[model samples]
Target: MTNALTITDVRKTYKNGTEALKGVSFGVRGGEMLALLGANGAGKTTLIGILCGLVTKTGGSAEVFGVDIDAHPEQTRSMIGVVPQEFNFNIFERVGDIVIDAAGYYGIPRSVAAPRTETILKRLGLWDKRDAVGRTLSGGMKRRLLIARALVHEPKLLLLDEPSAGVDVELRRGMWEFVVDLNAHGTTIILTTHYLEEAERLCKRVVILKRGVVVQEGEIAELVRASGAKNLEDFYLRV
Candidate 1:
C-alpha cells in the first residue's frame, strides 16, 4: 500500500544551534494511526510543523500522499489537516465561522464547507455551540472545535498534537472513539501525545524520539517486546 506520509532522512537545525530533528525517517500508511512519543522538546512538534509546511527543514525530504512538501508545499499541505496544540482561531469569532474559514483556506466553497462543518461539529458534540464565540467555549470544547475545523476540508491525513491535553477522561475517550471512527473511514492519523496508554490502545505503530533522534520505530507490540517493557510508557523510558 502507498504511504499517506513519508519522511526520508529529515533534518532541521535552528539558528540558535538547536537541532530539532536529526535524520528522522518514517512512513505512515493510509488508515493507520501512528503515535509519535517523546518527552518535551523531543522534536515531535517540529516534525509536525515541517510536515504541515509551517516549518522548513534544514535537510532531507518529506512527502504527503506522494507530493514533496518542499517542492510542492501547497499541494502537499492540501492533503493534510492539523490540530495544533495551541488555538489559532480568533477568540471572538463564532465556532461555525471559524470552521468555515478554515475550510476556505483549502479553497473549499462555502456550500461544500458548511455541510461538512455541521456534520463534524455535530459528531464531535459541538453542534449546539456552533453560534458561540470561541472565547465562550471551555478548553475542552475549544479542543474539539479545533479537531472539527481540521476535518472541514476532508483531509486524507490528520495530524493531532496533544489533543487530549486538558480534556476530561470521558471526553478524551470520546475523542479516541471519534478518531477510531475517522480512521476506519480511511483517514490516516499521526498524533503526538504525552498519554502513553492512549497511544498503546489507539495506535498500531509507535515511534520513540529522544532529543530529536528517532530511537525506535515499529509495531507497538514489537516495540513493547523488544524493549521488554510492560507498556509504552516503560518502553519509552527504556529507550
Candidate 2:
C-alpha cells in the first residue's frame, strides 16, 4: 500500500547554527498511527512543522499521499490536518466561529463547514460550549476546540502535537479514544508526544529522536524487545 505521508533526507538548521533536524526520513502508511517520541530539543516539533508547511526545510523532500509538499503546498495541505501544541485562536471569538473560520481558511464553504463544525464539537463534547468565548472554556475544552477546528475539513492525514499535555487523566483518556476512533475510520495519524505510555498504547510504530537524529525506529513491541527493555520508558533511557 502507498504511504499517506513520506519524508526523505529532511534537514533543518537555524541561522545561528542550531540544527533542529539532521537528515531525518520516515514514512507513515494509511490507517496507521505512528508515534514520534523525543526529548526536548530533539527536533520532533521541527519535523512536524516542516510536514505541516509551518516551517521551511533547509533540505530534502516531503509528500502527502503522492503530492510533493514543496511543489504543491496547497494541494498537499488540503489533504492534511494539524493540531498544534499551543492554542492559536482569537480569545474573544465564539468557539463555533473559531472552528468555522478555520474551515473557511481551508477553502471549505460555510454551508459545508457549519455542519462539520457542529458534529465535531458535539462529538468532542464541546457543543454545549459552542457559543461561549474561547477564553471562557477550560483548558481541556480549549484543546478539544483546537482539535475540532483541525477536523472541520476532514483531511486524510492528521498531525497531533502533544494532545494530552496539561489535561486531566480522564480527559486524556477520552482524547485517546477519540483519536483511536478517527484512525479506525482510516485517517492516518502522526503524533509527537512526550508521554511514552500513551504512545505505547496508541501507536503501532514508534520513532525515537535524539539531538535531531533518529536513534530508533520500529514497531513498538519490536523496539522494546530489541532494546531488552520491558517498556518504552526503559527503552528510551537506554537510547
Candidate 3:
C-alpha cells in the first residue's frame, strides 16, 4: 500500500529557543489508523500543526500521498482534513451553514456543497439539528459537528486531535464506531489522544513520543510483546 503520509527528519523550533519537534520522522500507510501517543508538551500537537499548515517547520520534509508539502503546499493541504481539540466554530452560525462553509474554503461550489453537507450531517446524526445554531447543540453534538465539518470536503487523510476529550462514554463509543467505519472505507487517520486503551483498540500501529522526539514505533501488539509489558498502558509508561 502507498503511504498516506511521510515525514523525514522534520524539525520545529519556536522563538525563545523552544524546540517543539526534534527531527521527528514516521510514515502512515494508506487506509491505516495510527495512534500518535504522547504526554503533554511531547510535540504531538506541534507535529499535527505542521501537517495542517497551522505551524511552520524549521527543517526537513513532509509529503501527503505523493505530493511534497513544500513543493505543492496547496495541493497537499487540500488532501487533508483536521478535527482540532477545541471547538472553533461561531456559536451563532447554523449547523448546516457551518459545514457548507468549510467546503467552500476548499473551492467546492455551493450547489455541490449543499447536498454534500446534508449527507454528512445525516451520517453524523446532526441532520435534525441543521437549522439550529452551534451553541444550541449539546457538547456531544458539538463534537460530532466538528467531525461533520472536517469530512465535508472528503479529504484522503483525517487528523483527529483528542476528539473524544470531554465526551461521555456512550457518545465516545458511537463516535469511535463512526471513525472505525470511516477507516474501513479507506480514510487514512492519525489520532492523538491521552486514552491509551482507546488507541490500543482502534489503531493498527502506534508511535510514542517523548521530549519532542520518537522513542518507539511499531505494530501495537508487537511493541507490547517486545517490551514485555502486560498491557498497552503498562508499555506506554515503561517506555
**Where is model 2 poorest over a 10-residue stretch in terms of lDDT?**
44-53
Q: What's the lDDT for all of these models?
A: 0.92, 0.91, 0.94
Top-lDDT candidate index: 3
Candidate 1 vs. true structure, TM-score = 0.98
Off by over 4 Å in 2: none
RMSD of each: 0.9, 0.8, 0.9
Q: Give the candidates in order of lDDT, highest first.
A: 3, 1, 2
Write model 3 residue lDDT over 105-214, tens digit each, in one string: 99999999999999988888899999999999999999999999999999999999999999999989989999999999999999999989999999979999998899
Candidate 1 clash figure, as a count? 0
**Tens digits of per-residue lDDT for model 1 on 81-104?**
999999888999999999999999
Which structure is stronger by lDDT: 2 or 3?
3
Candidate 3 lands at a TM-score of: 0.98
Model 3, position 1, has a per-residue lDDT of: 68
- Model 1 root-mean-square deviation: 0.9
Where does candidate 1 have its weakest 10-residue lDDT segment? 223-232
Among all windows of 10 consecutive residues in model 3, the one with the lowest summed lDDT is 12-21
Which residue pairs in model 2 clash with each other?
none
